[model samples]
Target: MTSSADAPRSGPVSAWAPLAIPAFRVLWFAQLGSNIGTWMQTVGAQWYLVDA
Candidate 1:
């Protein structure tokens, strides 16, 4: 039989834990904005090509 001390400690992990860091939060937002801009540019190019 396993005692309480021998049992594995399972804890709930927060998804937003990493965003708690100021540097990480800044980089995350910057990356998100870059991805959105790239997506918009791609869509615009496709629409222009299709219409031309």
Candidate 2:
């Protein structure tokens, strides 16, 4: 059995490690902004078009 200290580390330790890379951070934020915009649009559409 491997002890916690002896275990081989795998993958990025920090959740934000992927965003540390310039290319990944750019793409991630772009996607995040797009998703936020889409969410706002959907909410606006529902508010304007749906009956109470």
Candidate 3:
């Protein structure tokens, strides 16, 4: 008896599956913004310490 997980997929796994869902898209963008903000703060802090 084969379990569903052992079955071969019909095609290549979709890379866009997450974007197809609205909630996932929202969360993805939110995290992206958060990462950008964090990195900017990190770089600014490093520069300040190095210059001072």
In terms of lDDT, the best-performing candidate is 1
Q: Of 1 and 3, which scores higher on lDDT?
A: 1
Model 3 root mean square deviation, Cα atoms: 5.6
Q: Which stretches of candidate 3 lie over 4 Å from their true place?
A: 1-9
Query: Could you give me the TM-score of model 2 versus the true structure?
Result: 0.69
lDDT of 3 by residue, 1-52 (tens): 9999799889777898779889999999999999999999999999999999
**Could you tell me the TM-score of candidate 3?**
0.76
Candidate 2 local lDDT, 1-52, one digit each (tens): 7899799788769887688799999999999999999999999999988865
Q: Which 10 residues in a row give candidate 3 its minimum summed lDDT?
A: 11-20
lDDT of 1 at 25: 100
Instruction: Give the winner by TM-score: 1 or 2.
Output: 1
TM-score of each: 0.78, 0.69, 0.76
Model 3, C-alpha of 13: deviation from truth (Å):
2.3
lDDT tens digits, residue span 1-52, model 1: 9999798768986899899899999999999999999999999999999999
